[model samples]
Target chain A: MGLHMKRWTVNPETWGAVVSILGFVLLWYILTAVLKLPRFDKLPNPVAVFSAWLSPHPQFGLSIFTRGYYLDILYSVGRVLAAFVLATVLGVGLGLLMGWSRVFFDYSFPLVETLRPIPPIAWIPLAVLVLPTAELGVIFITFIAAFFATVLNTLLGVRSIDEVYFRAASCLGSRPRDVFWNVVVPGALPAIFTGLQVAMGIAWISLVAGEMIAGQRGLGYLIYEDYSNLQFVNIVIGMATLGLLGYGSSALVRMLGRRLMAWEGRRRGGAMA
Target chain B: MSAGGALSIRQVTKVYDPEGVHVVAVDNCSLEVASGEFLVVVGPSGCGKTTLLNVIAGFEELSEGEIRLDEGPLALPGKQVGPGAERIVVFQNGALFPWKTVLENIAYGPVVQRRMAKNEAQRSARELLRQVGLEGIEESYPAELSSGVQRRVEILRALINEPRVVLLDEPFRGLDAVAKSVMHQFLLDMFERTRCTMYFITHDLDEAIFLADRVVVMTTRPARVKLELSIDLPRPRDHRVLGTERFLKLKQAALEAVHEEALKAFQAGERELA
Candidate 1:
């Protein structure tokens, strides 16, 4: 609610973070705004970008006051949401089957290993050829990144459990289904969440690259358009907004993870695996 | 809580032939544990005491022979019945669920398999905790507790199941000396209160003599019973009993029996390596 309330006034401890952020901006201001060095003269200074970010009436017709800015944001967010949800459902389901059943692991894991290494952007040309719409192709790129991360991490989570727990559960008379739900599910959840955090970051990165190459309407597309039209300040604004959105999405994932795994916060070791 | 169960093991044999390694873990071993008796088995490291416990606990199938639990066939000639609620094992490393609260872990077995209501199981769990004077920390997770407390909670978790037999496989292997003695008293108190059949396995001869009514020593590998010595220590015994002449004599007998197997195991291991 309050990134806007006060500009770094309350806490002494948090001043370090404020200083770090301000220092980066100061270096950029010196490089371009003051010194106007060789390559720096071509790029927009932070002062120009900062004012453009706050301007209701930006010189380039896009800013905090512009409706087109939000429309671009909404498109990117919508695509990420659709892709992220599908990736989670597919990845976690596949991971559980692979982790629990020997037959499934033997049959599918080799193929998974074959496919996992291809970068998401590598799929752009094939996805565009196969998918009906460019938007779908961009989403496919995002989904691929998130799906691999989630599946691999969830599998590791399930495998990291101690074998004694399984023995103990069965000795306590748990049926196979009971052991699956009581032991495997809870034991793997912490690692699954770790995967989700990594997935969120990758999903956003892929979304931007996919938009630049294949998308027509999103923050990624806006950056490409700004560059083509020589609206350099607007391009920086697009990149900054995308960064903020990605950070926000990761924070949301972490919040959900914390609520689900409230017991995890109490471990004396003080780190989530 | 006093539903003691007698276990009869007859000509039991276990062979591990994975990838043609052809290792026999337990060979033609036969023993009977009377109902309510505290029986401790001592052997050299890697001498397969744990394999014997695993057989009785129904985690492993007998390659030959059978085990009976109170007249019921536990592991028979052909059928392999998996582990059940009637036999519970307290593992060497603590196995309490790190995710569940102390009370929730204690209540899990009864609530899951026994079909007790959740509230009813919790009530019994609290009562068990109160008996151990760990009353206020019922809501704490296992990771939040000290190792000593975690082991105590694990034992309470097993005891709450009211299993006919409780197995301990080197359960005190990693505790410090001070913690080990306190755990000794704690275990004895629980045993006296429950009177459940106990099948404990350890490499420590002193622990065996301290806790068991009878101690069985096994030979090095392809382990078979080498000697069985009765511990004549009185019931409700304490640390002072460790200083008595009778305890020392019993310890001496066990040490002598185990020392020979330890040496044989060393020689066998050396030959395998050489």
Candidate 2:
């Protein structure tokens, strides 16, 4: 009976994910290849797209085997990584200070509050004009997209720490600096990670949008270029690649969160009856 | 009063205003504690027992009067000193840092103060853990331990700093009966060994009688001292002492004092509601 319950409970989630993905693909194939609806007919079939991707010298002037394709991937990944890292460091530092010191919060919070609501995409024209180069503009847009989420969430995290913890730290003879490091930082970490995950997603979105609007190369640029050239198969491949890379980078953030928050996981697990 | 841990609280008062509703929490409370003395404060709930502790710990400002440590004026009305390593409070809820392991929590005070190197702190923490009979749980987080174990760890965390005075705010309030009894014995043992001056606040008369060298009972809200009783119970006190005639007499007297204050507070609450 226990074994039967285990079997029923464990595999359903795994099976559900697998089945849903397969079913989605099958439906895509049926619409494009089998039924051949008007809009679907205009789009490339799954087989055509896969075959194009597999080709030695693909139609869109790149493939997995091509150095150009790798470069496109590299450009996108590097931009995201650099922007995300910059956003995280700045966001956390500013957030901690803003949360811990009333004077700092009073001085900066109004400016942050005013700017945070303005969408990262909305800054594109201004960024392009102000920044020295188009690449820097794109990076700035991506950085802004991630930075606000991290900063706000990290500030909230620091504020949310119980008052008693501060009392405990002070009573333990923690200097102001030590309190920031030992109590404020660790206390705010779980929330900061939540911010990082969100920031990672937003960074990708802004990067893609920025790339599509500006010149040069990235997965986003590849997709837009293919669409303009009417290479429908390459567009599909580019879309697929973007989806996979977004999922991969988000997964990396989640993995790091899990490693850092092992203690929290154990604590929460123990709390449950 | 003993030599090292002399603390004098002279006519201290604390008042608060919540949404412009004036409330007096502590009223003209005065007390003194000697070095290595185990002094317990007993009172009815909402009788400002905790407020008194908070005032003494320098976590809250006094509205009147002064507090002196070793005959040196420590804090005064409207200008309070912040919490420091010389005095640490062990909260009832075992406010152990959920993120740190037991060893880290115990070692935090010394390491943060730069009084000891990290390795030395760890070594001292290990010794403390052994003394407290919590030897193997150093690597475990507070959440992984039982509530009883957590309380023990909290005490160790406070004591590791060798604070001049340890303030315990009903430190065994939520434990099971068995766990509470064990903690009582453990606390007795610890007090015997270290002889650190402690100012313990509790609503439990039995607990006050069991642990205190002297017990101070406080009156209802806007609290002040109602009674003071010294327990001359023999040392190495254990479970066997609970049934003694002298212990029973002390418990009965404390209960009477607390019950009177509790009744007054209850009637005052009823009057306010009406």
Instruction: Name the top TM-score candidate.
Output: 2
What digit string (tens of lDDT, one per residue) describes model 1 on residues B1-274? 8668999989998888746988899999999999998999999988988888998888887788899999898998568778988899999998998888988899999988966889999999999999889898888888888778888889998888888899999899999988888888899999999999989999887788889999999988888989999887899978899989999999888899899988888888899899
DockQ of each: 0.50, 0.55
Chain A fold similarity by TM-score, each prediction = 0.91, 0.90
lDDT of 1: 0.89
Instruction: List residue ranges in candidate 1 displaced over 4 A.
Output: A1-16, A122-135, A269-273
Best candidate (score: DockQ): 2
Off by over 4 Å in 2: A1-16, A57-62, A269-273, B1-4
Residue-by-residue lDDT tens digits, candidate 1, A1-273: 755666645576568767977898899899998999999999999989989989988999889899999999999999999999988999988887788888999998999999999999999999999999998999999999999999988888899888898998999889889888888888899999999999989999999999999998899999999989999999999988987898789989999988888788778456321
CAPRI-wise, candidate 2 is: medium
Give the 10-residue window scoring lowest on summed lDDT in candidate 1 chain B: B14-23
* lDDT for B75 (candidate 1): 93
